[model samples]
Target: LAIAHQYVTQGGLDYAREILESALGPRKAKEILEKVQQTIRTTGFNLLENVDPKQIVNFIQKEHPQTIALLLAHMEPKNAAPIVSALPQELQVDVATRIATMESISPETLDQVEEVLVSQIKSLFGGDVSEIGGVKAVAEMLNSVDRGAEKNILGNLERENPELATEIKNLMFVFEDVLLLDDRSMQRVLKEIDTKDLSMALKGASEELQEKFFRNMSSRAAEMIREDMEFMGPIRLKDVEEVQQRIVDVIRRLEEDGEIIISGRGGDEDIVV
Candidate 1:
């Protein structure tokens, strides 16, 4: 029963229940299954979620945009984001547009896509498909991707589908978008950031962004940050990006907690008060 319950939580509910029914009578298995269902929230079963994003990217890169969109739409945004980022810039925009504008995919279509995915990744097991994709999903996926890819995709998307692009852009908040915060919100965000991370993150920041943070800090503290960055010398772009992402995550968390407000851009209406 414990093992079966574990399987249920790990996205093998049907297989778990089937084995339980064989080991125990239908009545016993049914009772156990019912209890597990009531106690645990399943994210539905998706073997694709466990596969490495790089492997998925290699297999799907040559596929049609719509086919790639269908697979990514079914995946968790975190997993899907990297795969999208890894694609060629042109394909990235094509797939993102498909995901944003995508509607419900018929089960027949899903089955066909699923077969292709499973056959390519052979180790992937069958699992249930739930509804996914649209502007919100695209936004979430874009939010996880690197700034360069995000900008490139959105730029192309803006030309291809202006309305849809605006909707997606409205939902996203990139690392550089921290500049959208007011002085009060920026200070609040700064208080939560580590000095080391701030220095590293600012290494790759634009002059305008550096000034935004500097203006919020005491003159002495801002000078110290500049000294640290100057002494650090050449740093890997990947390391800089990682630290910037962490700082952006802090900003998003503070915003979610209502401790800060990110002002609107991309023609969003300004706050009245």
Candidate 2:
């Protein structure tokens, strides 16, 4: 029992002392347990404080599912949730089950796991690991650039990594995403964006999105826009994309300023307000 208590305490389980005290009724043991757990929590979270969730997921994906489960069990829910969700679907169930069934991890084992994670994070920054690229990062980057640039970059990324490019495109909020916006938010964004930019942006937009925009406008205004788009024939794809990106930038700014709400990508809640 003394060895068990020592293991529990060293493992940073605050409840270890509680269990010990229940049987032994020792106050000093409880105090020591509290301190140990506090130290572990502080140190562990600090190690991951600057690490991105994607990097963590990538690092752990190479580990055993049980090991991944154990590591996540020690992490904050906020940090762990996305990593878990981002994991391959088949592994998610296995890892989640492992975490649920996990009882106790030896302190030495925990330390090893932490050391591996920390080292992996260092490797990522040291360029030992492939740079972390994700749909969210790509979409956010494209949102800031001209359409032509966005297309060129995405085209290159696609040729090199088709899967990644596809994922990024799925995450990106195109002119089509405007159709998903609430009417009020759409109106709010439309009010802020220049009509010319909107017209050019709509040139490449889906018909559904174009009609949604028309429906939101007065009939006369909608007719004027349609006429303008028709008369502005043979526009370059680059110019269309550039103007579209400009409109997207406006919507992004509106969303950022809290004037409009942009729904999240990949069927998720907005990660950032």
Best by lDDT: 1
Model 2, C-alpha of 56: deviation from truth (Å): 9.7
Candidate 2: lDDT of 165?
63
Write model 2 residue lDDT over 191-249, tens digit each, in one string. 88788887888888889889889888889989989988999888889999878777777
Error of 1 at 36 (Å): 13
Q: What C-alpha root-mean-square deviation, in Å, does candidate 2 show against the real structure? A: 15.8
Error of 1 at 39 (Å): 16
Please report how far candidate 1 places residue 179 from its true position, in Å.
Answer: 13
Candidate 1 stretches greater than 4 Å from native: 1-45, 123-130, 174-273
Which residue pairs show collisions in model 1?
none
